[model samples]
Target: MNVLVIGKGGREHALVQKLSESPMVDELYAAPGNAGITEATCVDIVETDIDGLIALVHSKDIGMTIVGPEAPLELGIADRFHEAGLKVFAPTQKAALLEGSKSYAKAFMQRHEIPSAAYATFSDPEAAKDYIQAQGVPIVVKADGLAAGKGVVVAETTEEAIEAVDDMLVNKRFADAGATVVIEEFMEGKEFSLMAFVNGKDVYPMITARDHKRAYNQDKGPNTGGMGGYAPVPDVSAEDLTFSYEHILQKTADGLIAEGRSFTGVLYAGLMMTQEGPKVIEFNTRFGDPETQIILPLMKNDLLQVFEDVLAGKDPELEWEDQASVGVVLAANGYPEAYKKGMPIPQINGNVYTAYAGVAGTDEQLVANGGRVLLVGAKNDTAPEAAKTVYQALKQIDNNTDYFYRTDIGL
Candidate 1:
């Protein structure tokens, strides 16, 4: 079957790479793919170009199209493709609202009795400020709509919370995405990502992964999608994983079905392990960037087969490797903010995998083209061992100085 994977990032790159390895896939393609996705033929249609994409799918006789990012799903690409009589693996727009709107997700969690932080939504800046002040310090401020991954701000002070409110509601930093805000009490605990292949109420959870959202070392600096991550997190106990699967991921799938917004595709829960149990911090309707790069490699089952079986309402009986996988992002020098691009990507040597997130050109001509340039990952019997091997490969690019990556991944 000819398959087309949408989006242009590390996540899409991983999907393309994995799908290409499937014998069920006769021809593989990626829309607007980055430089590192050599396994699939890259298409030029942008993810938001619904008409163009539909036409391309028909023209190429693509059997299945997998949506990789939230933007196109929020734009109802799946709905459009279905309308055009095409097979698309993604949730409808209404179902994708769980990730597209923070306020909507908060309300849904409340309605479904799912565990999450207590939050209040506001459109007025003054009202938001007042609430932040009353809530005291250490709160979370989030833009109601998608802002890439920078909409969230964990404010430790009332002043900082107010500032974030002003930025979203007053300064319009995130544009329309920030017009409304959801302020929540900061839940204290370690964070982990649990992604599952979801088809309506049927959910198959993947291995747990811990993503380092902070840009700099020791958890400092602003978040930039994700800086690094490791799968099969050692610190997360098996009991906790079971609790998260049942209370969080499973409940969410059932809730979406009951709400008349049945979801299909990757459902990612950004969760925190509180003293009480696992609670959702946020949700993503598509595969996570750094997390996908690390976790997908650990899956023993064929990627296309999993998607097909899930779509058919059949159990894929997914299996994963016993080895641990760690991935680190190589971002532009001053990432999570403004930075330069087009710096030549150095040749990576060693037994490691590379998922190009942001680059242009091909082969030796590849150059950094976005904030997060690429991800370097490795698999080993232990997380520490994988991290060591990945970091050693990254040292090969350190001399360029135009890119930077976290030094403490999987520590």
Candidate 2:
């Protein structure tokens, strides 16, 4: 099968790499792929640039295309691909609203009787501040739209809460995403991720993973686009996974379908294992980044087969190795904020290394392309064992600065 994967990030790179190894795959291509990916798979056009992608797909006689980013899905790229007679592994624009708008997802969960944290949405700065003060601290303030993973501020104190709301609503720091805020009541517990396959109404869970969302280590820092992740969490427990499927994930899928919206591709459910059981933290329409880097390699079935099953509207039976996976992301210094790009990169080690090509420059000398420049992943039969394998594999990259990765990812 000829597969064209959209996006150029670590996730897309991993997806392309995995598919390229599949016996079922005749050829593989990544759109505007990074330098590392081009070595493994053919490179196409830009992911966000739809016309270029479509033209490349058609010109190359691509059999199927998989979108790896949310921006294109939100822009209705799947609709366009469907119109062009191309098989795309993603949801429609209407179905994508579940991730496009924070408020919409919260409302949808409520309507579907999905368990989640209680909260309020506000547009007025003063009212929001008053509500925060009245509600107390340890709450969450979120930019209703995407803010590149830095939108949600889990304020630890009343002062921080006040500052967060004022900064978003009054100071206009978040601008468009903050225009209409979703101030959710913070639910404290162990947070984990559950990603599954969705072909219309059919859902098939891939693997369980937990991601370190904080930019720095010790789980203390602003939200980032995942610093690292590990699969088959020892702490997630068998009971917890089952409870999540029954009380959380199934409801979410049913709720979305009930709204006359059927989802396809990946369904990433962010859940907090609260005392009341698992409650949804949020929903991402596509696969998680660092999470994907780890999970996809553990899949025992052909990547093309799983996605083809999704496209054919079938609940495909999937299998995985009895192992865990760990992936660590290396980001440019001062990421999720102002930072320089196109700096020479140092080789880092790992079992599989992928570059996002965030910086369009020479690949021979590694360059800082995006906030997260590279991803290194490893797999083992145990989470702790997999984490150590990841660390050992990273020795392959020759970098001086001890790159950023969460020490407590699987702890």
Candidate 3:
């Protein structure tokens, strides 16, 4: 079958690589794909250019469409395709609010009795500042809408919290995404991520992967999408897993369905294990970047089949390798801040898996284009050791660019 994957990130590259391996797939194409995906035929139209994507699909006679990013899904691209009788794995616009609007998601948590953080929303800058001052230090400031996964800011002090709010509201940093803000009391705990295939009724959970969001090695720097990640997070007890499935996952599916919305495709829950229990930190409508690079490598089954089941609204069983996987993202120096691009990118060993993100230019040699350049992945007996091995393997690829990556992903 002819398939079209959307987005231009490591996650999408992983999708492209896996789908290519599936015998069920006849031809594959990616929308606005990056340098890492040059091996896979890529189109140039950006994902947010929905009209262009739709036209391409129709012209190419694409049989199936898989969305890799949340922005297009939130913008109702899936609904558009479904309306045109095209098979798509993503949910309709009405159901996408689970990740589209933070305010709506938080409100849903309250209504469904799902365990989540305490939070307040604001549209006025002064009100946000007032709320921040009243709340004291160590809070999370987030833009109400999508900001390319760079919207949320976790403040460690009261001063930081105030500045974060002002940055979003007063400074117009995030523009429309920051027009309205969500501030929540900071919950101290370890974070774990779970991405599952959901077709409204059926829920197929993938293996858990924890992300290292901090830009620096010691978890002190700013967040830049994700620096690295590992699958099958160690020490996450079975009880917490049950709580996530019973309270967070099950409740979420039932609640969305009850509200006349059927979520199809990926449901990613970013959870922080608090003292009380596992509470949701946030929800993503699709897969995680570095996380996906590792998670896809561990999946033993065909991705096209799973996506097909989602599009057909059928229950599909999911399977994954027992071994653990790890992924580390390589970024140009000064990422999540001002940095240069279009630099020459060197190649990694043929054995290690590499998925590209910020890449432009044509054919032969790939070039660095985005904040995140590529994701390095490998699988082994355990997650921690695999992470270490991946780092060692990545050391061989050299471009001399001011690249940065976190050293302690699974450690």
Kindly list the per-residue Cα lDDT of model 1 for residues 61-172, writing each as its tens digit.
9999999988998899989988998999999999999999999999999998999999999999999998988888799999999999999999988888999999999999
Clashes counted in candidate 1 amount to 0
- lDDT digits (tens) for residues 205-252 of candidate 3: 888888888889878888779888888887679999988988898889
Tens digits of lDDT, candidate 2, 1-411 = 778888878888878878877787777888777766663454646667888888888878889888888889888999899898888898888888888899999999888888889978999988888888888878999988877678888999988888888888888887888898888888979888899888766788877888888888788888888888888666777887887877667777787787888787788998898888888898899988778887888888888888887778776788888888777777777776777776776665545554353545554665676888786677777777777776776655435452455555554
Which order, best to worst by lDDT?
Answer: 1, 3, 2
Off by over 4 Å in 3: 397-401
Q: How close is candidate 2 to the true structure, as a TM-score?
A: 0.94
Please report the candidate that would top TM-score against the real structure: 1
For candidate 2, the per-residue lDDT at 18 reads 80
Local distance difference test values of all predictions, in order: 0.92, 0.79, 0.85
Model 1 weakest 10-residue run by lDDT: 394-403
lDDT of 1 at 356: 92
Q: Candidate 3 local accuracy as lDDT? A: 0.85
